[model samples]
Target: MAEVLGAVSSIVTLLDLAGKVIEYLKSASHADDDRSRLRDEISSSVAVLMMLKARLSPTSPHVTSLQTTKTLAAPGGPLEQYKSDLQTVASKIVPSVGTGRLKVTVDKLAWPFKTTEIKALIASLNRQKTLFNLALQDDHLSISLALQGSTDALGAKIDNVTNDLDNVKQGQKGMVHIANSTDWPELTVPVQTEAQALEEKRRIEEWLSPLNFWITQDDTLRRRHKDTGGWVFDALEFRTWIDSPGNMLWCPGVAGAGKTVIA
Candidate 1:
């Protein structure tokens, strides 16, 4: 519970920093395309943090969750680092209160960050967002493991989450953005002959897998007991991962955890 409280405090501070960034972006009259994009990206990142805050609220379901929160709130950890970076950005972009009127006016009309800098900030935000998403998934898995009463299984899930966190801390892929349908008209695909299409299909099949995954999926579904793993479908992390394009739900459990059935 102490760890959870610490994690929530970090999240609240981050939210406050993020709000500053958004506010300054909105107020910048001379903001260009990059700044606008940065604003949108920051907003999306904030949503991930909001979800994380909700997960840490009240009592988390299991020990793994407490472990995760502890790690996140540790000194020099991901959440602290994220907060530091965001504060730096906010300091650069946000206008100072004690500035002269003319200086404030000039600041409001000028964009503070370079294009390269904006891109780097966006990338950092995306990385941290991915890390938080993984944390939320860890919390969900912890709940399931607690219900099953498998201590070994819970430890294994904790290990998996820790590995994932390390990778994310080293900088990994972030939220997958799905382009709107309106962007379809901008795409230019080449025309393919019947032979070419067949060749392409063959390549896709080979790339997907050497064996038929559909058959394996069918078998797993057949083995699934009715109402089993239904909680997974209803979990916040699961629904968020589904509704948000390119987001992944990392469900790690020992064998017989019904992973395939949940899928």
Candidate 2:
């Protein structure tokens, strides 16, 4: 149970770190090359972390849902790939910035920081990567213990652990929601404005309701087509004409030739 809680904590910590990195990326300005590469790395790390959280979830039905047939695995199937991606980003940034020199304040990095500050950011990112890897390792060990029947002695304690993990996930989700609402006002504001816009659109639609009256009903025509042998419509010439890119296909005939039904 303690191990489970610890793993959850580690995953949340990694998410928090990744969020900070993403926030920094959003606010900071850099050369196009550096900006694109850094953004890609950060986005990839966040995506992998999210998938890792889902895969590690104790309550997730998909955690143990393996198929017997050959199938494409989820992108972040092996933990090594996630770790390697993060490590690659870390290594790219760490050479220029020595470790342990930068202080990380929660959600409070001044935009457009100096070189030293950027170094600090990189150092923080590396620390997050290391911690994330360690957490994944701990989770793997926990699963091993479970598989080996070590957790059998815990019995009902397993349920408690699952409940605790769920609570933790809920708390993390709430925190993320709060962070997003606080950090990105645009998200919250647009929702209300969009609702208002939709309401206005509904009113306009109501006002235009009478316009629908001008449209003629085609149900009678449809019924006539159904009464007749519909196979005539599927004839090669008819199909060829329909498939052609020309804007109009005119079927000229005498009045009783069922032109209206075909049309």
Candidate 3:
């Protein structure tokens, strides 16, 4: 953990130095296309390093493997190579404080790196940036896999809870019983006569619609043989529709296609 923390701190210092170098290049008195390219490359590398620092930081939610972190921060590793190359670039571009400074005067600064050297440094930074991006992507994949596993586990637990609740509801229904009482007439459930029932059904049908859906359903079922459409219930698509809420299953066909019978 301490090693990772130290690594994070080192990258922070590198980023700061890179920033200074970029700023100095931006303010150079002389304009060179190669110099601008070098500054852009340094800027891109700084972005990559910033991402690495986030992954290594102790406060980060992601748990990057210790081995991976150590490998990145290891001696002569990618980060080290980046630091060495970046410092070389800085020494050539950024002026020193004392007599070692390369400025011809207080206002005019000197450009020391040739076109080929600047191109070489840019190529080096490109390679290091690729490495940093790869590491961050690996961490992203790990986090995604972890979240998927948790979601699967939670779904299983929810299924178990749903089954348990169903069982409890069934048990309660079975426990229901009619108690014996001296006043049996008062306790008895009222039963409507056949004529009264028919009259009530007709009234409801008339109040709702002229067509009687219940009679149509009865006629359809009567014409269908016993268990004629039972195979429809066994279909995988039908089962999935039943399991999922707010799902609709449409069965479309020409006339006399058994659509109504199956439904």
Candidate 4:
């Protein structure tokens, strides 16, 4: 099954590489030297793809697919080479097509893709890849949740809540209330202005939302600032607040002397 699918995958991969190079050319993104290098790379990939095809089952279903293609149907094109190689391998697997489980299913099918169709498919795939990459870079896209309301109000019996709200998830891809304990999930609180949206984007990137902070190094007498993300504070100028042993805070001591310790 993989052999059959591998043949298709390799063909698509080859086309994708070609498509990307052409896109780079149109964008003027790379120099002539880069284009030369990429063309060389594509040629090398094709050679390796051919070698892999030869090693797979000669009776694989793709040979039947290749036999009817116009490009290689005659001589010297991809289909001709594929068909010839399969024949060389076929006898070892099966004496005749009737006896073989992997029998060829030849057809008079036309080229499945014209230049425009191929280009469009490749471009669409590229667009999807770009979108996912952009999503990954976005801090908001990396789902996180913090309690929107108080856990005490949630009640001791409340183990979960529906994640359809209070989650910065991407189409069912992010964590749910289950992760709200680790970091208060960043909210996409909507505002009336574009300025507010831009501010929210920056605030998310700046790590300003209330988070789980702990003292690390346990021995610095000066606790090192640490967050759930494992990012460490390297500067010591503000280490006094963390060093004071009495700085055990639920929040940042923002309102007043809410909680204190007696030594």
TM-score of 2: 0.28
lDDT of each: 0.65, 0.45, 0.66, 0.33
lDDT of 2 by residue, 132-195 (tens): 3323333333232332334454444545554655565566667667868685755432222445
Query: Cα lDDT for residue 14, model 3?
Result: 88
TM-scores for all candidates: the values are 0.52, 0.28, 0.49, 0.19
Error of 1 at 176 (Å): 55
Name the candidate that leads on TM-score: 1
Model 1 poorest 10 in a row by lDDT: 172-181
Candidate with better lDDT, 3 vs 4 = 3
Model 3, residue pairs in steric clash: none
Model 2 / residue 258 / CA error / Å: 58
> Candidate 3's residue-wise lDDT over 1-263, tens digit each?
78788778778888998998888888666657887898888898888777777867667654345645665677876678788888997777677676676443424666778778888888878776766665554332322223234436645655655565556555544433232334454454334445654565556435433434465456455546788778889999889999999999987663234565566
How would you order the candidates by TM-score, starting with the best? 1, 3, 2, 4
Model 1: per-residue Cα lDDT at residue 143: 29
- Residue range with the least summed lDDT across 10 consecutive positions in model 3: 138-147
**Per-residue lDDT for 1-263 in model 4, tens only?**
44345454544554444444443333332234543443344344345444334333356321322211222223343433433333322222222346655243322212222445335433433332232222122111111111122334333223222232223333323344335445556643332344644555555534432332232112121212334212223435335557777675332331111111110
The residue-by-residue lDDT of candidate 1 on 135-243, one tens digit each, is 6655333322333334486456556655655554333222112223345655443434457545655664454334454654564455567897878888999899988
Tell how far residue 238 is off in model 3, in angstroms. Answer: 22
In terms of lDDT, the best-performing candidate is 3
